[model samples]
Target chain A: MSKIIEIKKLRKVYGDGVELVALDDVDLTIEEGEVLSIVGPSGSGKSTLLNMIGLLDTPSNGEIWLKGQNISKASSKERARLRNKELGFIFQYHHLLPEFSAVENVMMPLLIAGVEKKEARHRAITLLEEVGLGDQLNNKPNQLSGGQNQRVAVARALAGHPSIVIGDEPTGNLDSKSSDMIYELLRKLNREMNQTFILVTHDMDMAEKTDRILRLVDGKIVCEMLRDGDKFVTRDLCKLDK
Target chain B: MLELFVAMKHIRTRKRQTVLAVGAVGLAVAIIIVFRSLMNGSFETFFDIFFELAPHVLVLPKEGEEYIYLYKTLIEFIWAIPGVAAVSPALSTTATLSFEDNVENVDMTGVVPAELNKVTSIGDKYMIEGDLYAIQSGRRVALGDKMIEKLEVQMGEDVVASFPDANTMNLVVAGVFRTGVEEWDQAAFVSLETAQEFLGDGDVITYINIQIEDPYQADEVAAEISALGYDAESWRTMFPQFEESLAFETFSNNLILVLVLLIASFGIANVMNMLVLEKTREVGMLMAMGTNQSQIRRIFLIESGILGLAGGIFGTAFGYLVSAYFNSLQYTVNAPTAPQPIVIKFLVDPFDLIAFSLLALILSMIAGVYPAHKASKLDPVVALRG
Candidate 1:
């Protein structure tokens, strides 16, 4: 399978004098159709890494290659175009605009891509139905439950039919039942469309379900786990000795 | 298209704020339109009175001379001027009129009645008693109503008129006229032959009044007439004080308009700033969804544009209705120069309407810029953290 994304020597430093390294000397690659999870504790740079890969932020010193282009040196306009055409993002909080209906929210990415309104609407409706929100298409984010809103976000993330989707603790705000349902839905969509997903989460069980996992500790990948059928084989390198 | 849709949605979601911003602009536009219309109406009325009561151009002798010596030749020369509609020769002097025990000082104008009537509308419409031809025969005089009353003399009675050169004559009061102007009503008119005879000057006249084909072209005609070795004055040059006052009125009116529009623009700016602050999270979400900074700026600009358009339309309609209502009222203004109170009517100029509305629109759009810039420059990561 072709590599969908590659990162080399990624380093992100915050503040000038008393510098804090968010991601230090990181190297990573995501293959096509890979379901991957990045697990880390608070302040461990999981979100920072995902942000760099999603083209939402620039690394201080690194090169990020998305599909074949070096996006780290890309212009703002070029970055935005790549982000819109090739990548989708889901935050910990469902960021569906409260003023828009479910279908309207789902159609946002396609609309941003300059698709015709009528066609965007038709595609958005199909995506929403796939996410089991067919009957709630006209409901606004405020009117829907938290779990339902997250599902709407999922549908929105896929509206542009991007090659890769990035999620930052997408199910962190939901209950166990809702989290499980979201996980099942994401897996079903991933297998059906062969779209790669990079999820950042603290939930170990959710991390174990993915095809591969990378454990981050203090801005460095300490351990990696690969799934074999129904089991996860762990390779531990560093311990949190505080 | 998406930018417009999002912009409209933002405005629709914040109904109260949008209405208040729009109302501020509307009120400013309406006030400016009403004030300007009234000022224009007053100026127009004042000029209308001048055009009706006086000649468009007047020709006088060269400096240090009291009369045009070759008066008949000058009159014929002026009559042949291209734009000259009519020319009437007149001799004016301060004189005293006495009838029995009553005597009053009056300004007397001597004119050829037939020629004067063609040059001015003062004769036909303002005649209260006798005809304009009554003064053409013999040593007859046509007195204004106020002058007749002051002298306590009846029509057809004789009055002793004495000129500054100690020349006196007994003139019959043939008619009484009222021009609805106090200054004009206090004057008396007689034939040019009688005036020259009374003043003991042979065939000499003080000035010649010329009416032109187009009143607005008075300056060019006056310049042409002045080239003929005479001092020619257009109505504007004749009334410098009135022109100064008119200019000052226009300047103050425009100043008020700018001040009002400035205040309204601040109101719009304040509303948009608040909206930007309130929607910071949504802005972040949009940016994260791949909306460029220019697109975000366009959205806010479109919002302000919509507000301005709505306000301009509403204010124009409201102003027209209010001006119409004012015109329908029976209010009158009393002035010292006018014999009767003049009725007030608001004169709305289409140019003023278009100008004020366009100014308001531009101001509102300018007000949107700062807030739109702030919104566009917001960092998506920091905004999402909020």
Candidate 2:
């Protein structure tokens, strides 16, 4: 498979006097049409990594290549364009604008991509229907349930038909049943659209269900798990220190 | 268009704040309008009094002479000038009038009643008791109301007049007139022929008062008339103090207007700043959604513009209504040149209304700049966390 994204020796440091490293010497690659999970404990830089890959933040020292284009030195405006046209993001909380309805929220990303209003609206309606929110097209975020709002957000993330979707704990705020539903929906969309998805999660069961899992501990990738037919195999590179 | 829509939505959601801001602008605009209108009306009143009581151009004799010779030829020559509507020849001198035991010194003026009527509206408009033309037939005199009261004389009563030329005569009072000006009321009037005969200044007159077609062209006409070897004084030259007062009034009015608009702008700025602070998170979300900084600033500017427009329209209408009510009420004001209390009336100029409204709109738009800049400069990362 062709590599969709590549990171080389990425380092993200916070604070001035006493530096705190969020991501240190991290190197990773994501292939096209791949379903992967990034599992980490709290403060393990899962969100920092997602933000870096999503073009939401700039790295202190690193080169990130998205579809063979180096974006680490890109201007903010160019980065924003790339984010709007080539990538999508879903947060733990549904960040849907309270003033806009579900369909309108779904239409936001397409609008940001400069799509005509009529066409954007049509595409947003189709996406909302696909997410089982066809009956709640006019409902605002506050009027909808938490799971429904999350589903609307998911529809919004895919509205621009991006090549890769980055989810920072997409189901973390939902109940167990809603989390399962969201995961299943994501998996189904991944298989149907043949699009790459990188999800960050702490749920072991959810991590086990993905095609591949990268375990991050203290800003370093310690293990990689891959599914082989009905069985899963794990490789732990950091275990040699024990 | 989207910016406008979003701005309108925000304003609608914050109804109380919007109303307060709009009301502040409205009240400021209304006060400015009222103040300017009243000042304009008062100045107009002062000018009207000056114009009605004095001729636009007064042709006087040379500096050393008391009266102009060949006055008839001079009158005909002045009448031939373009823009000269009418010219009335008059003679004035100081005299002492005695009726019973009351005695007072008064400035006596002699005029041709018919010619004077053409030069000034005073004869026709201000005659209270007797006919102004009655002075033409008999050796009769018209005593001003104040003069009559001081002399304690009745109509048709005979009074002794002692002139500066050692001429004394008993003249019958034909009329009592009041011009609402204390100085003018203290003067007495008689036939021009009578004054020339009694004062021993025959075929001569002190001055020829000239009215013009356009009062504003008085200075030019006065200059043209002065070419005839006589000193011509325009009303503006006669009363430059009034013009100075008008200038000061305008300056004061403009200062107040600027201060009022400044206060109103501060009100708008305060509201906009509060709104930006409240919507910090929303601003971040919009930026994250690919809204440019310029677009965000434009939204806030449009919001302030709408508020200004609304306030301007409402305030202008309210000001007009208030001024109209003031015009309906009758009040008396004392003026230095007026003998009686002058009626006060408020007048609104359309130019002032339009200018003030535009000023309010511009001030409000200016007030939006700082807050809008603050909103546009918000960091998406920090704002989203907010």
Candidate 3:
């Protein structure tokens, strides 16, 4: 599989005088059409790794190669352009602007990229329909249910056709039914469009469903697994002792 | 353009704040227009003092130069000049008109019947029980409107005017003349021959009041008159104090305008700054959406300019209404000289309106600069989080 996002010796540090590492010499490679999930408890750097993938936070010591460019040292304007045109983000909270209707909120990314308004609106409507939000396109975020708002956020993130969709707890605020719906939507989009997805979630049950899983503890990945065909396995599952 | 449109939406959403901003701009424009109008009034007053007090130019007796008695010779010579409008000679004297129980001081002007209407317009507006042309036609004296009240003399009744040269003469009350101005309304006008007769000078005159075809040409005519050995003075030369007063008014008005401009600019600055602070998150979103810094700044600039233009238009309309109402009101001064209120017309010149609009716009734009810059400099990451 071709790598869509590549990271090498990635390090993330917080605070000034005495720096604390959120990511310690981490290396990652996410391939096209891969549904990858980063699972960890609190303070396990799952969010920091997700942020680095989305280009929202910079690496302290590493190079991030996206598609074919070394984008780690890109100027702020260049980074903003790339973010607008090539990246989409979904946070733990469905951050749809309260003032805009679902379709308008979805159109934000397209409008920010200087797309014509009519075209952006057209695309946003189609995307809302794809996300089962056709009836709620004109409804504001406050008027929509938790599941509907999250669906709008998903539509917004996909509006610009970004190569990689990174979600930090996209279903963290939803009920179990809404979470199931979001997880199915993410998996279905990954299969239909063959787009890369990197999600950070605390729910291990949801994490176990992705094609690949990276479990971290104390800012370091302790185990990495890849589902083969339709089987779920760990390093011990394929051992002769099993 | 989208940023500006969104910014406009934001401004419109908060109507109360928008009104405050526009009101500040309106107040500034109002003050500017009023001061401009008052400045114009000051200019008109100055021009009047000059036109009424002095002719365009003055021809005077060169020091120790006696008029080689050129009234007849000079009149024929000056009337032939292309610029000379009309030339009249008058014998002037100080006298007191006394009735049965009243007496008042007067500058008695002995004017020729042909030149009486040409020298001053005060004679045209004022009339007592008798008529001016009737008085000038017969052997009658015209008393000023002020003298009529003081002397308590009736038309067709005779009064005794005693001249400084000791000639006491009995002249019938001809008419009363009033022009509002104290100087013209207080002076008595009579036939020049009658005045010369009263002053005991049959031919000698006090001075000549010359009117050129165009008051603008008065200077040239006066110069020529001086060459003929006579003294000529324009209205401005006569009353230097009124000119000084007009100049003082101009200076003070300019000072007030500067202060008001500063205050107006400050109001705009304060409002824009608050707007920037309040809308930081929106600004970040715009920046993240690929809006450049300069473009973001233009959004706020348009907002400020719109406010200024609207306020200016409102202020101008308001000023016109206020001035029109003020002008229509009868202002009673009850000045002992002219008892009735003189109608003052407040003229609104176009340049005054244009200047006021331009000044408010410039000040508002200046006020917008700092806040716009701050908004443009905002970082999308930090600002969005904030």
Candidate 4:
């Protein structure tokens, strides 16, 4: 119902002598409590867009507003603070610290935000149980299966109770069954907690499960699809010329 | 606190690397401690032998004067100085002693037995045969034990002594002493009256020996006495070579310690760098979780500091054990110039040990800085992509 994030004229260019444009003049908006996905080919800048929203990378040119605050040019420390307090991220590889157990991995963001250890641990356990990882609390990432590790990563992302959760191909490394399970879990969490989620993926089936889908090609959104009664219907052709 | 927890976990999980790094640092510290203790022990033993054999300060006659004519007043004046423990005036000359079959050159000194006993340890510590006080009553001599062997004479035997342009005298050997030091053992002592008669000088002495409460305060005490227009010298000034050698030994020992510690610190740096490289992805995840660059740097520093502390403790314990073992053995060492061998007991000062441990910690921290900085500066996106 309300705009949670807005990006205008976003651009990311890499290299010194010969520049390669990763994202070009991208304009997008995310609504609160919405489950949405960005679907595109492999080199279409979907992950780059996810990284920008997650505050994991600096943009060369952009105006990004998160809950009415402009954070496009925030200092690195401030960016980290915003990322910890307002955003949660799940990467394709799970990216859990190998030295920590599942519960500890879930508790990291809470601890980083200066939460007490006991409280963080309790909340992390609750989140892990919610993600059906109750029995794997003390298991390290290497000791767990691909699906179970992704579940642990999901629990970790939700541990901070962030306003927005961002996933960059979170299920890309898992099998189809594990991928569907992850999608179901994300859908359930979005409904129960009323938290917004933005996923980047190439799986058309996974994209169809979200409330809305944005199709990207050559760093530009060409169309958007809205879910209507168990199916997605294209709203309009919003293609940008090169 | 979380940073520390993470650091500790990192160290714990890498068992082999941690042990190797810690072992390198520990071995370096142990080597430093052992060598430092041995050098300190040897110096202590050397100074003990030197101070016992010589006076803290000696007052000689003015230039061109053969003897101190006003020796009595000079002795009284030296005795009045603060920290002066005892003062004795003595006359000494090189003379030859001849028995029936053997003859040898000896340094002859004359002293008042009571005063000499107070200024030197000869009467109390070195006497092996008849009493030095026996010389006070008659024209008797206390000869060194080695001289007794060389001259083929026994205690209570009469020997003929002669000096340049002085009448030869017949003296009976009354006491035998052994100091374990060649220079002191080959000397002889007699009554002051006998020396005055033999040297044909009336109530005069060659030098006044002054013992002090602290041997290290010799320079200050000697300076005060020298200000009174006498040729005064401390034992340190008299033996410049010994001082130089002691200084050189300390310098070389410390140089070795620095080099070893530097090498050990490089090993720490190398290990830490490898850890940083290996944990690049985890570092990116931490950054994504809101850990600042400074916090990232602190995590690595704390890890290295813990390693250094662990190593220092282990090394100090190992060094103490080894030193104690050697000290218990009471190994004998031969000083090149001395005729006797000394029993060496390793002594490690507690303050020196603490300082060396702290030095190890500081050096390891310095070595960790580069790697920590590199870890902190990593790009989260690129690192995560790895």
The TM-score, computed over Cα atoms with residue i paired to residue i, of candidate 4 is 0.87
Question: Per-prediction DockQ scores?
Answer: 0.63, 0.32, 0.22, 0.72
Worst 10 residues of 4 chain A by lDDT: A233-242
Off by over 4 Å in 1: A235-242, B49-52, B60-140, B149-151, B159-172, B178-186, B191-216, B224-231
TM-score of each: 0.87, 0.82, 0.72, 0.87
The order by descending DockQ is: 4, 1, 2, 3
lDDT of 3 by residue, B1-386 (tens): 45555556656766777788778777777766765765675476445434443344444444574422446666688679896655666666788888897888788877764554555434454454566666555457887666777787777888888956657888888777666566766777778667767877556665666666666566667667666556666645565676578678778987788688668768778888898898776566555444557777887887777667666777777766665565566333434544344444465777767777777777788888999889888876566555
- Name the fnat for model 1: 0.48
Instruction: Please write out the lDDT profile of model 1 over residues B282-381, one tens digit for every residue.
Output: 8888887888888889888888878876777677778877887887895699897675688777878988778777887888889999999999998878
- Candidate lDDT values, in order: 0.87, 0.84, 0.73, 0.89
- Candidate 2 predicts chain B with a TM-score of 0.81
Judging by DockQ, tell me the better candidate of 1 and 3: 1
- Across A87-183, the per-residue lDDT of candidate 2 in tens digits comes to 7778787888777889888887777677877999999999989989999999989899999999998998898888898888899899999899888
Candidate 2 lDDT, tens digit per residue, B52-161? 77888889997788788878887777777788888889998888899999999989888998878877676787788888899997688998899999999989999998
Chain B TM-score in each of the candidates = 0.81, 0.81, 0.72, 0.83
Clashing residue pairs found in predicted model 1: none
Which regions of candidate 2 fall more than 4 Å away from where they truly are?
A: A1-4, A32-36, A109-120, A160-163, A184-196, A208-212, A224-242, B49-121, B133-140, B149-153, B156-172, B180-182, B190-238, B331-342
Clash count per candidate: 0, 3, 10, 0
Worst 10 residues of 4 chain B by lDDT: B333-342
Position B376, candidate 2: lDDT: 85
Model 4 over residues B129-195: C-alpha lDDT tens digits? 9998899876899999989999999987899999887668999999999887777788999998888
